[model samples]
Target: MLLILLGVLVLHLIILVLLLVSTAANAWTIGSTGSTDLWYKCLTTNGGYHCLPASNEDWIQAVQALMVLSVLFCFFSLIAFLYQLFRLVKGGRFFFTAVFQILASLFVMCGAIIYTVMSPDRDVSSSFGYAYVLAWVAFPLSLISGLIYIILRKRE
Candidate 1:
């Protein structure tokens, strides 16, 4: 039981970290000379790297909002999980945590899909970057974690 609890905690933590990294890392789209993220578009020039605020496109803004919300919800879910772990009675389910986590995963999925559909096709050289991949990766993990939380009953 201890090992199972620890494993769930670790998985939750991993999802949270992945959400943070995917939200903050400026590598959603990578081009030959630059990269673009939710907040900034950065490029490398002659011995210098420059960054500028992301465009005001509605899709980009939506993605930004969704990603931020995902991180917030995931973090909140972790806190809720910890709180419930100690306070809940034996046989109680972590429903609150599961709901928050599932919502976080949905947010991530929506944000990534919006970015993929709306991002400009800069050129043949440009491609989705590691951070984009991470966002995609986190979505399923979060979903799975949420399901696990739903099924996990507090044990004495």
Candidate 2:
């Protein structure tokens, strides 16, 4: 039981790292030109290519904020999980850990949903490549980890 809980905690941490990296890469790509800092000609003039400047900076900022929130939640959840493990050994219930886990999952879900609904079509189909997929993948793993935490119990 302990090992399983530990493994889930590790998975949650991995998902958090992946989410942070994906967000940073995406922000860089959206904020810069293909190879130069100059405004991407393709983005500013034409709309066929993926390396286009964002149509809405506000949307980008929102996504970035959500990503940051999600990362924070994941980090806190990790700490809570570790603390819960120690408490479990001492025969304490994991009320707080479970709360943190659920909250983290909710934040990830919100971030993922916002990206899915508000993201420009061109960015996902053309610009982001694997980065977009990675963000979506992190969502489920984080949610799974939270669910595991909710179900976890110390065995005598």
Top-scoring candidate (lDDT): 1
Off by more than 4 A, model 1: none
TM-score of each: 0.97, 0.69
lDDT of 2: 0.62
lDDT of each residue in 1-156, candidate 1, tens digit only: 889999999999999999999999999999999999999999999979999999998999999999999999999999999999999999999999999999999999999999998999457999999999999999999999999999999999
lDDT of 2 by residue, 41-132 (tens): 23333534455554455655566677777777778878887776766664555666666656666665676666666654434334543555
The alpha-carbon RMSD values of the candidates against the true structure, listed in the order shown, are 0.9, 5.6
CA-lDDT, candidates in order: 0.95, 0.62
Model 1: lDDT of residue 146: 96
| Poorest stretch of ten by lDDT in candidate 1 | 115-124
> How far does residue 87 in candidate 2 sit from its true spot (Å)?
2.8
Model 2 TM-score, all chains together? 0.69
